[model samples]
Target: MATKEFDELALDGTNYPIRASNIKINFASRGILNTIEEPNDGDPEIEPRKLNTALFLLRLYIHKDLKHEYMLETSPLNLWKALKERYDQQKELIWPEANYEWVHLRLQDFKTMAEYNHAVHNICSKLKFCEQEPTEAKKIEKTLSTMLPEDRILTQQYRTNNFQKHSLLIHTLTQAERHHELSLKNAQQRPPGSAPLPEVHFNVQNNAKNKKGFKGNSSNNPKNLTGKRKRNNNRRKFKDRKKGKGKDKAPQPRSNGNKHCNMCGSDTHVAKDCRIPKHLVLLYQKSLKDKKSSENPRFEAHFNLTHEERLEVASSHQAPVELESNINVLPEDVAPLSAMDDMFIEYCSTDPLGDLQ
Candidate 1:
């Protein structure tokens, strides 16, 4: 860490083979490598300071327990030799395990090319420290041989590239794996008819429940009466406008003592609750006409009939035309008024569906 060189490794005996190799690199950077390899006495002036710096680093990083044994050694060359002799046997001790790892290394065993690359490099590094480093071609062959059965064609292609270095082979594998993954993802994206939408589990916010309680949906809402009852309800609403609100509430007072008479002229007192029809209210009718009310207007209609037209109108209706009960029908040989007959004829003509039938 102190110098911009190969990092110092702890002098742990178990990993002494790699550790010693790293130490050599560390010493070489300090210009004190000759002190270790040539075993010469460093110059009393320049070499002593460089040797001392190297020796101090070596002493500082060694196993703390082993410090006492090498503390008395003054010369760096003797000290360096002493460390090698003590830990050099580590290479022989580690040789079999490193050989086995290199021999058994396989690309297929690793889930990713990165992991396979790391494994190959790790084993190669250890083998190199043990002085049995694998050749570039041998490492390349190892990868090809260990590939999955499905990747035989891919392995052959890599072999055909004549990769001169192990690193080039590793880069090729990584790039190939990337393209292969892209192909798989592309294949998965192909639509059969249309790509299925991701399943969503959600509720419509309008009718959804809150934290307080569950909400009422359309099905849970109050139901109105159906069929004939529904028709009766609509009729009742229209009728309510013509009449009063309900039988429960009282109507406007007609008492002479209370207010002026605006409808029918009557001397006898009428209960306040009694309803007065709008048709009897001349004042209201006058005001409504003055306002020219478009929403509600009464028009007197006309009626006329030809014999052929009468026959055709009669044929259009599915139900038997109830002549006597109809508003156009008159008793005692009296002719129906023009306005009444026209209303009945117009009602039939307006019903387009009934005309087709």
Candidate 2:
């Protein structure tokens, strides 16, 4: 199992060397295999009934971390071989098939660590391996067999047997392996006190000591309890009072005549009259007075204009004409000849030339 031999084996494309140095070795002179205490989970370190419980946990761990099925279509022998090859350097060796079979049968229907441990206890009873002496294997078997297969074996009460060993070991191992290394790199790395590792940090501020975030403020002070209750009662009372007042003030039926016009359509002038200009109103009044006066007999003289007078008035507005120089009339001839000549001309015009003589 030299490193060179392992390298050669790697060159040959075999996953594992024939004699890997890391494989578990039996240091005990008697050649009997050793059993290291299974890493104590914080649960009460109940004595294991069968070794397979540890193997189950280990297998589960490997499967989850490796993200692959441990023994898909693979025989139990192959699993044992692989386990021995990889982790044989560890203190506990996975037992041969006969012991494995005995352990596996007990664990087939195990639901919790307690049930599994009890099964281990049953096997230990038959095998007589544990320090706490086995008394009643038959009784345990009878009870377990008769119990419904679907029965939940774990309870909240037994959730953590709170093994001191597990707690201390986890703290030591995690700190030594992880936190310590991190602390060396980061000066502020403080190992978690003793709180259980949370799946998620739900409490943004971890004030578990004061219950600051875990419970509301009202829960802490008992004196404020009655006051809060009173406030809530007052709120309800106010709402009830409002509802009662609303009922009292319920709407009454409306009357028709009492309603007022929306516009200036009452005894007062309408919107058109209200908006009419003052000057326009004055003009309308004057026009009405004129119309009334025109219908009266007293205004007749004022109304009539005689024909000549009307003509004189009409001619006064006509465009003036200029007379030519040869058409000038003599004053005496034009003046006296006007009336008489008109008469003589009217008389003689009836007789032709004889009337003229």
Candidate 3:
């Protein structure tokens, strides 16, 4: 290998090390030189000074920190999409100017730490939007007083590229504040004695049979005038007597065995309890049954209907019939059909077999 030193060069101020190794520069066969040179060995890592210089240049390029300001003004939803795209394209490596500006702008300038953190995260949440930030995240922790815990973690995740932004911090805060205010207002507006414990009112009617006494209620003591079993029996006897059944022949309650239909909530009936006429019920039963049996069911309930209600439903359902009786025969002396009518009739009459000949 032959090395061309800077001292040998005519007069260029900067020193340039020219490589002229046994490995020939293939300028002829393939058009461009794509192979790596031994000196600048194409290692993945760059020198610290060079890296620092690149960072400085990147910082300078994003001078105004427009990315940060934009985040503060724009919605978190918009900032996230831009950040993810910039990060994925290796903008941080290839075009640091664009990358830093994109992230910084979206992250910084948030009015609240929560807003700032949330904005940062929304940008990083590409793979999984539901991703969360580490508990020990720094930025949110620094501004703990102003920033919500979730927002702090979210910001750290986005800034460090660990988690995707799942929820908007601003919205969550707003909703929480609203709920709190509503609760406070409700608490204040409530009546002082609102919802007081329920009380039962007792009604007493003096039968005037004797002096003021516990006429209806029973006493536990056998010596008391009214006893529990006796009181109950007396009430039953009074009810039977009021019903006008024979005094000795005890009155019995009705045993119709009719029960309300659970399906339609109709009184003491199944679908058969529907107010639809018996003939219509029979006609439509198959359709109703088939529909009910299917996944999507449409069962109609018709409770016992008043005469007016029955008439209304029947009238609504009945198709309008064009009655010949309602048709008024125009008097010949009144208004006669114009000449156009005769022409129309003649035209229509021409097709006799087309009509009811």
Candidate 4:
């Protein structure tokens, strides 16, 4: 047991000297503690020897400065007592103010439960060493009071539950912390809005009707429909000019007396001798027809010409019949009028034509 006590004191190093009173008490309980005075003849020197051995071990472990000052003493027990009193006086004088402040003021400043628990444990150990340890309830109360505002509800709940054990309170707070972390993670993962996007449905029937109306209008619209007819007429006129099949074969000079071509509005020739392409002339005629077809009574009366006159105008723009030709027109190139009508309908259906209007 003495050997074990010496080993334990060795582990404490020089900084924490073993108490002289504790050593004496342990030795007395073992019936080995005694004074170091010389004994009578035939008395066993065992107690004195043990005291010398303890003193030697103590001197070996103590700091060099302490040994130089206290090692000269003849009585090992008195030496031990003196060292203890000196060190205890030093401790009482130099106990740090910061440590006391932390016990009272800074305990609550720990950010995490682990940190707070570790600090509280250390404080409790120090207080226990001084024989002044606080109760577990006080420790729990201090911990709950110092917690962050976010844990206020949990703190209140724990208080309401009136938890009897400090371990239970700590376990509950840690679990609450984990739950709070999980809830924050879930909130971050979710999208901001609760409302979903609206569904859109196209009215196929109404679209089909609108498409048909647009097709009909595009097919019957004189402006766009007569373009091919005018081009055909222009081709015929060009052929006639090349063949010199008109009334005036020679190049005509520009007429100086305001004799503009009625078909093309040029001050060069009469309407009959105008050099305008036959297609253009036909377009002009279609424009005139459209004007006559309008709601004007004067234009309607002007269009009331004899059948022979109408026949003469039609014959003037007619294409010369081709006897034979090498160029074969592909069926794909010459799309049927009905197909063209459908193309215009599809275009009008897809595009909003209000801007054009």
Root-mean-square deviation per candidate:
25.2, 28.1, 34.7, 29.4
**Per-residue CA lDDT of candidate 1, range 132-246, in tens?**
9989889988989999999788778887889998888888778978998998897788665677675454544533555338456544544533455778988998898778655
**Candidate 3, which ten residues in sequence have the lowest lDDT sum?**
13-22
Candidate that would win on TM-score: 1
Residue 71 error for model 4, in Å? Answer: 1.5
Candidate 1's C-alpha lDDT? 0.71
**lDDT of model 3 at position 240:** 69
Ranking of all predicted structures according to TM-score, beginning with the best and ending with the worst: 1, 4, 3, 2
What do the candidate models score in CA lDDT, each in turn? 0.71, 0.42, 0.41, 0.62
Best model number under lDDT = 1
Worst 10 residues of 4 by lDDT: 6-15
> What C-alpha lDDT does candidate 4 achieve relative to the native structure?
0.62
- In model 4, the runs with Cα more than 4 Å from the true position are 1-49, 94-99, 102-108, 165-167, 175-357
> Candidate 2 on 238-331: residue-level lDDT in tens?
9977778434565554534544332322333443435556676667668777988767524233323322323433322233355576665566
lDDT of 3 by residue, 185-225 (tens): 87887677697544443232333433365445334446454
Candidate 3 to truth, TM: 0.18
Please count the clashing residue pairs in each candidate, in the order shown. 3, 9, 5, 2
Q: What TM-scores do the predictions have?
A: 0.49, 0.14, 0.18, 0.38
**Clashes by residue pair, model 4:** 230-279, 234-279
